[model samples]
Target: MNLSVNVQEEQGTAVVYLAGEVDVYTAPALKETLLPLTEQSSTTVIVNLSDVTYIDSTGLGIFIGALKSSGKAGSKLKITGANVRVKRLFTITGLNEVLDIEEDQREEV
Candidate 1:
């Protein structure tokens, strides 16, 4: 499956909306788009995964890299709208504690 990423800016936050699978083949695209945002000083980068059905280790690595960059650049990284399966991956990897993730109340149909 292909991944689609859409970015938008609201106030001082950079919101990234992702759809489809995030794996080895599509992780590079997310990294390219997200890493740069994380480098911005005093900025907030939010990754929305409401429509993201699957995410692999490679994709999680990209988020880890982005989180590190955000720290050094004095930016903040937030993850939101992750479905149950994706959230479980983070929990299992212990990244759920390291990264700021906001739960959305939307149920997947």
Candidate 2:
């Protein structure tokens, strides 16, 4: 699986732009990429999946883990630009209820 992440720091937020598959083979990379940002700044983490093409359970776990870490640090973690398939994964896993997800401007849970 190939994954690419571009992180941009702005004021009080880190915008992470993700692309490619986020699965067991790549989830760890995702975690590692975000860890430094989480530790270095007290800013809201925004994961933008507009360019992401695919994701699996392991990827979901990474997001959940990031959320947990951000919560512990009193920072916010949000997911945005999820496509229909990714949105379905979140819904089926009940992750939509636990995380702040926004698609095209409409907020879900």
lDDT of 1 by residue, 1-109 (tens): 9999999987879999999999999999999999999999999999999999999999999999999999999999999999989999999999999999998789755
Q: Quote the lDDT for 81 in model 1.
A: 95
> What would you estimate as the lDDT of candidate 2?
0.85
Which regions in candidate 2 have their CA more than 4 angstroms from the true location? 105-109
lDDT, each prediction: 0.95, 0.85
Instruction: Please report the TM-score between candidate 2 and the true structure.
Output: 0.89
Error of 2 at 99 (Å): 0.6
Q: Give the clash count for model 1.
A: 0
Which pairs of residues collide in model 1?
A: none
TM-scores, all models, native as reference: 0.96, 0.89
